[model samples]
Target: MTTLLPPASTTPAPGGGACAAAATPAAAATRRPVVGSVHSWDLSTGVDGPGTRFVTFLSGCPLTCLYCHNPDTWRMRDGKRTTAADVVAEAGKYTRFIAAAGGGATVSGGEPLLQPVFTGELLHRFKHELGLHTALDTSGFLGVRATDALLRDTDLVLLDIKSWDRATYRKVTGRPLDPTLDFARRLADLDKEVHVRFVLVPGLTDAPDNIAGVAAFAATLGNVSRVDVLPFHKLGEAKWQALGRTFALHDTPCPTPEQVTSAKGVFETHGLYAV
Candidate 1:
């Protein structure tokens, strides 16, 4: 969560020259302009990707996860109407610095796939125009919305597996586990690079069998390069309270260092790198 707030203002940075080479005139003409509900944009490092990232948090999501900290982002109407070009322009302001740090651009949630077309445009422009590495941060629930072209533009994917057991998965995110597993398998088939994410909730998802289930599935995906064992935290409890919603996991304790280490060991046992 090392995030820097969006700059007060942005100017169009140099280089849309790549745009001409990126698409054919007829294709560009037929395509509708990309617009989206954007909650915010900022700079973040480490967890989001290999280097510092200009992360665009698109608004709206289908899931109502009990542990979601950014409840403010749940509704699409709450976000500002933004164009994909404008978002890429803002990221351009930091292109040099980001490239210097070996960082890239990340399209994050509410759920990037919630606005697939907009998310796709941003990824395409971020890579082709900005000449930066690009990552897609998504839950993979709407993986069907992601066209093959979108995945091609995305250099990496930060996919949240969340849970393994079907019932437990629904309890955590109010969604079925099948779609995520299906998406993981698809990414594997494509040989796409993926960093599988799991949030270790002490009483909820920390069960040995549940963790083992996730580890075992992820290990089967040849494309999985890393397993991020994130411990659940209540930092967003206030956001839930402020929004007048009861934070169900209000009293959920953050997993201890030992618990985290143990969970990491589970993935390592499956021959996957864990962090």
Candidate 2:
């Protein structure tokens, strides 16, 4: 629940060169772009799909969601240095198993868009080289300029909509909601497949009206594949303490199953499929 804003100045890699030459045929097949930082990878968390899917937890995020589960990933300099080729080589080992189980690599983080060049390269290699499914878990706060070519190779977009109301969104994420909504609309317009996710945080984002509003907005989009209502939990409380950060939702309890069900119902009522 710690709410630490990202530093004002983030140093992106110069000229945005390729991290390294794709050594293998799989790597050579994809055009990998150069990026600033090669943070760490998360071999844990099997949430991407079936099989043993590898996850790359990139550094940096723009949003300050009060109930973020991975506070440790907020900083832009916390993990080890690695390049796109490094990640691809590591993930390539389990490509066969992942593909057989309908699973592949998932790029998650404080916000993958913060390192768009690196993310795009990873997706390119996953598709053109390894021929594996690629998914991006983002907050949708990134602007149109940052998402242009990146969306072309992404198979699935896990778009997290913090709140429906503009004012409420600012309160929850410490950023304007318009950019996020615009990004979602652009994804829908481009016919990109997306899964709209909303975190149901009690006393903050679980309001009935807000849920209904988000559903209504999603109904206007043509490429919405599903809506996922994630119940709030204190999974990252300890991380906040370890980081010496103050938790914002210290007294907030986890949402009940009924609450999650009700929120899902709202999306269903709006003609958008909810999961």
Q: Which one is best on lDDT? A: 1
lDDT agreement with native, every candidate: 0.86, 0.75
Please provide, for model 1 over 1-275, each residue's C-alpha lDDT reduced to its tens digit, 9 standing for 90 to 100.
32223333323234556664355322542464557788988899878988999999988999999999799899987877777777887899999999999999999989999887678888988998899999999899999878787889889999999888889999989999898888889888888899998999999999999999999999988899998999899989999989999999978899999999999999999999999
Q: Rate residue 270 of model 1 by lDDT.
A: 96
Give, for candidate 1, the lowest lDDT window spanning 10 residues.
3-12
Q: How many Å off is the CA of 150 in candidate 2?
A: 1.6
TM-score of 2: 0.85
Off by over 4 Å in 2: 1-39, 43-52, 145-147
